[model samples]
Target: MTHASCEPARITEPDLIAIRDDLASREPIFHRPEWGSTRADFERMIAEGFWETGASGRRYSRAFVLDELERRYASPPLDDDWESCDFHCQRLAADIYLLTYSLRQGARETRRSTIWQRAGSDWKIVFHQGTIVQDA
Candidate 1:
């Protein structure tokens, strides 16, 4: 029998704080609807909005993220969950911002966050995470 090893993905305190700041607010920090539809939409969002997932202990390189995205595209199409998403954003610095949101699909609900940094005239994501909310 072979045991597969898995590493827990972790994000830094500052990044966590940035994400939390967005979540703490009742109002959305920013709004962009075009980046929330299909895999291609999200890929465009990732490419144009984030540099990378600046998260530690996870395989979140640009190639990795792209590959993962491609894999998702290979699967059956998902519902347009973003249409019902509750989103929020917070600025961590002059060009650094955190976006957080919750989405519901079928019977499952998930909370997600991403950190973005502005480079030149574009914004790039440096970190991302999604957590499923379970019923009590």
Candidate 2:
């Protein structure tokens, strides 16, 4: 049997735009991890208080966010397929974004946003927040 060599999928501008729109609109159905990871645990974390926004409008804890994403959201078999872009930056090359979505039991959409910073060759998350855009 001959084996076929696999190629990586390329990300494009439209893809980025779609991702931005999805997050901005809170369309949770399409939000999944880029690495094909699961988000069940992240969803749970959000359900809890790990990803909550306080009255001060600031996130409660970055440690909770990092831990949840790295350990749970980015795990195998689940596959988080979310996407994002640096729309606020003057140049796309200097801006970065991370986005995700979660739905309520009734299938309502909630979008998550995380601003990223480039460190060497990897993108590190500098900020994370999410909002419920619509019910349905």
Candidate 3:
């Protein structure tokens, strides 16, 4: 007989639940319609210096990402379902935080991280990266 088991995913640190919940709801970034569906709206959520490293290991700049997002939003996909779990957050500085989680889109899965900075009551995206999980 063969048996298989996997270790448990990380739990969100109790101290960071409030911040983690707030950010998790908006993660996988442009998926939540309630958050905002327009490019201008997205532009407001990300910092001027925002950037990302895709699961492909390619770097994307603020302008490039926004432009690509604008194009995708023009005619949104019908099957846009994705799920995120195992969120964990840490304070990077005063009002700055780092959030990490696992994201699954259909069969594709990746580990994601985002840096956020809070200005007053609003959070702005600073940096984000997604690395493909092998043998998942």
Candidate 4:
């Protein structure tokens, strides 16, 4: 009898790009012009075990992110114009993906990345990090 090893499924670059682009579209949900709309959007997508690193050098848990998001939503509005860099995505596993990009709002630019995992029928962000870039 011969034993065979099973390899994971393969993903093409184009497919990976599509997946990444789809996820990126969700970003504006957090920063929409209308606070009420943003809050409503945030509530639907957050998943368990979500963690993120803030540009301020602080680590936040899912609960903390939610709380902070709510507080920010309640604060006075601001004039925010943001520019984003090209997105890069990689498939870490059959169901895991990594995405990286940069966004500049005003004079501050931050490089950000996120790891997304398949959660049942939908995708959810498992980890995220944002680092301030000294030079644009």
The RMSD (Cα, Å) of candidate 2 is 14.3
> TM-score for model 3?
0.87
- TM-score of every model versus the real structure: 0.50, 0.37, 0.87, 0.74
In candidate 3 the C-alpha lDDT for residue 90 amounts to: 86
Q: For model 3, where is the 10-residue window of minimal lDDT?
A: 1-10
Model 3: CA > 4 A from native = 1-11
After the best TM-score superposition of candidate 1, give how far the Cα of residue 123 lies from its true spot, in angstroms: 2.0
Positional deviation of residue 83's Cα in model 4 after best superposition, in angstroms: 1.0
lDDT of 3 by residue, 48-89 (tens): 999999898999999999998888889965677688998888
| TM-score: model 2 vs. ground truth | 0.37
Q: Which candidate should be chosen as best, given TM-score against the real structure?
A: 3
Tell me the lDDT of candidate 3: 0.87
List model 4 lDDT by residue over 1-136, tens digit each.
3333463233448868778777677553356443234555565566677788888888988888778777886877576688776677788898998877788887888888888777777667788888888644
lDDT of 1: 0.53
Candidate 1 clash pair list: 29-89, 49-123, 49-124, 49-125, 50-124, 50-125, 51-124, 51-125, 54-126
Q: Which model is ahead, 1 or 2, in terms of TM-score? A: 1
TM-score of 1: 0.50
How do the residues 44-101 of candidate 2 rate in per-residue lDDT, one tens digit apiece? 3232323445223666664555465566544353644444323222113554555543
The runs of at least 3 residues in candidate 4 whose Cα sits more than 4 Å from the true structure, single-residue gaps closed, are 1-12, 32-41
Model 1, stretches more than 4 Å misplaced? 1-59, 74-84
Instruction: Report lDDT (Cα) of residue 30, candidate 2.
Output: 21
Q: Which whole-number lDDT from 0 to 100 does residue 77 have in model 1?
A: 48
Flag regions of model 2 displaced more than 4 Å: 1-58, 69-106
Task: Please estimate how well model 2 matches the true structure, expressed as its whole-model Cα lDDT.
Answer: 0.43
